[model samples]
Target: MTAFVLIAHGSKNPKFQEIVLKVAKELENKEDVKRVYVGFLMGKPSIEDAIKKAAANDDILVIVPFFIAEGSHVVQDIRRKVEEVVGNRKKVVYAKALGDHPLIVETLYQRYLEAVRE
Candidate 1:
């Protein structure tokens, strides 16, 4: 089975983690997604812990950065942390940061339209 892990820069506000978890829940319902986990760089259930939990049964892990762009956390920290935890035990794939996806562009346009309408 393959698991999807969403890595995010944690926030002190509880709502931040809740939103990440909500995304994970949505992913779990996707046809190809067998499992979903959320981890943070700054808070509880750190990236290491999330990967460990995901790797326990799944043979492949797809790490998706929820960051706006490929910042230091996505470019370096995420890869280093995953390596430290899994260490080639399973196939690991990295997805582009959220902002890189075309859907984000559409979302941005929609938000802009909404702002101008109000």
Candidate 2:
């Protein structure tokens, strides 16, 4: 079983949390993944707590950041924090942000095509 932990920049608004949770749920439904956990950098159930909770199972863990860029949070804050919790854990893999993927470009292209059609 592989556990996936999604790290996001937590917002104060409940809607933001809801969106993050939704994404986590969707990822959990994937056939390859066994569990999904959501963690926030500045809000409730901080990254450390989430990692600790997921670490209980001895399953392979993958951490994905929801940030749009390799900003300070992704480069320094997240790296430092993840290292602290993942100490001596060889199964942990931190994935790049969604923004770095080509899917984002594809989504933007589809949006532009839709607008042109309208």
Candidate 3:
């Protein structure tokens, strides 16, 4: 089974956490995905801990960042942290952020159409 860990920048607002957890739950329901976990760089389940937990269970681990653009957080910080924890544990795979996808454009278009209707 493959365990996917969605890493996000932490926020104090409760709603922020709620949304992240909600996304994780939705992903977990998908097939082939054994479990979907979440980790916050700044808040709970630091990157290190999350990787450790994921490494323990699944043979395939995929770490997905919840960022749009390729920034320092994705390029440097996350890489360093993952390297430290993963250390030849599980088969680690990194997924790019949700950026410039056709679905995002379609969603925006739908929103615009709704606003125009109103």
Best candidate, TM-score: 1
Model 3 TM-score relative to the real fold:
0.87
Q: Model 1: C-alpha RMSD to truth?
A: 1.3
lDDT of model 3, residue 101: 83
User: What's the alpha carbon RMSD for model 2?
Assistant: 2.2
lDDT of 3 by residue, 15-45 (tens): 8888888988898888877787788888886
Worst window of 10 by summed lDDT in candidate 2: 52-61
| Tens digit of per-residue lDDT, candidate 1, span 1-118 | 8888989999999999999898889888989887788899999789989999999978889999999998899999999999999998899999999875789999999999999999
**Which portions of model 1 miss their true places by more than 4 Å?**
none
Q: Could you give candidate 2's per-residue lDDT for residues 1-118 as a string of tens digits?
A: 6678889999889899889989888887888877777789989779998888788874677888988988899878987887899877747877888774789999889999999999
The TM-score, computed over Cα atoms with residue i paired to residue i, of candidate 2 is: 0.84
Q: Considering summed lDDT, which 10 consecutive residues are worst modelled in model 3?
A: 85-94
Please give the distance, in angstroms, between residue 50's alpha carbon in candidate 1 and its true position after superposition: 0.5
Query: Cα-based RMSD of the predictions, in order?
Result: 1.3, 2.2, 1.8
